[model samples]
Target: MQNVTVVDHPLVQHKLTIMRDKETSIAGFRVLLREIAHLLCYEVTRDLELEMISIKTPLETIEAPTLKGKKLVFASILRAGNGLLDGMLDLVPAARVAHIGIYRDHETLQPVEYYFKAPADIADRLVIVVDPMLATANSAIAAIERLKQRGANNLRFLCLLAAPEGVQKFNEAHPDVPVFTAAIDSHLNEKGYIVPGLGDAGDRMYGTR
Candidate 1:
């Protein structure tokens, strides 16, 4: 069985703990979310392919390793994903961004897509779909499906937290794409929410409900 990575970096773990606390204010939540996203992005992009190029330095000419090909397309799964986007952009300011919106249907508990947009050249870019939580895996799966349909083949999923059940479901549904998360919790509730998931990510980030 494929397993999702639970990043154990001290900075990631510390920020995640603070964000999980109910007493953490919206401002604090937003700040910490971005900070953790940056840390997580660092780990996720560690294996990005690099190419060496000759460059002229002030003192002498030298060879330097730089990223090859098109910049990555950071697709945010809307609202909460925006928090992660801010931090990731700080690390790779040149990367393009795409937005996808998905909401859970209260009655069916399935994902409903409200918006989807991406770069026309998605096929050639490394696409990283991001969300704060991976609960039932419905939204993430749906988002990836849409990306694939739009010709995005090289892809990855990034989240702040994930549930074991969701990770299993996601791997089964789309094993080609690896998932990275700060932590993988126990299981999901019947309502499709991850247990102790820091509450509704959209609501927590936006100060709603």
Candidate 2:
């Protein structure tokens, strides 16, 4: 898929494997998730535009290349997404943050929005939506839809793991929004969970389920 990017870096793959293990404790899983997120974030923003600016160093003034245009906006797709959000913030502290709270209806498997808050100038910045898992794509599609309704144009989706079905649905729903993932696992199960996924992301991260 043209819109999908899999960060296969050694470090990212290693951490992802550890995270996928059923024996990994909640504390350990959270730590590994954060570490993997940092690596994935690097790949997600690798193509950001840069502009030259004059800056004075300790010795002399010189032209320096800095990120161009408005500061980026990291949009977290609620609870589990925050796991990736926390680590990404460590890399780009200046970027604005947004939280999109959406949940899936258990029976219908539809998305339900509960809360959303984004930067006022969302239209002018690149918005990267973060989520730990992409299983059904219902929440992801709805989250991006909400962002667009609020005037966000430039957008991308980032996740720790993705199922092929979810990716296909997401691509069909929003072809313009590229997806970044550390790994794309097997198909989803009958219960809508990724076959080899790390279980419910929010549940695993919080030890709730």
TM per candidate comes to: 0.97, 0.98
Estimate, for each residue in 63-144, the C-alpha lDDT of model 2 and write its tens digit.
9999999999999998999999999999999999999999878788888999999999999999999999899999999999
Enumerate clash totals for all models, in the order shown: 0, 0
Estimate the overall C-alpha local distance difference test score of candidate 1: 0.91
Full-model lDDT, candidate 2: 0.93
Residues 100-179, model 1: lDDT tens digits:
99888877879999999899999999999999999988989999999999999999999998998889899999999999
Whole-model lDDT per candidate: 0.91, 0.93
What local lDDT score does residue 167 receive in model 1, on the 0 to 100 scale? Answer: 92
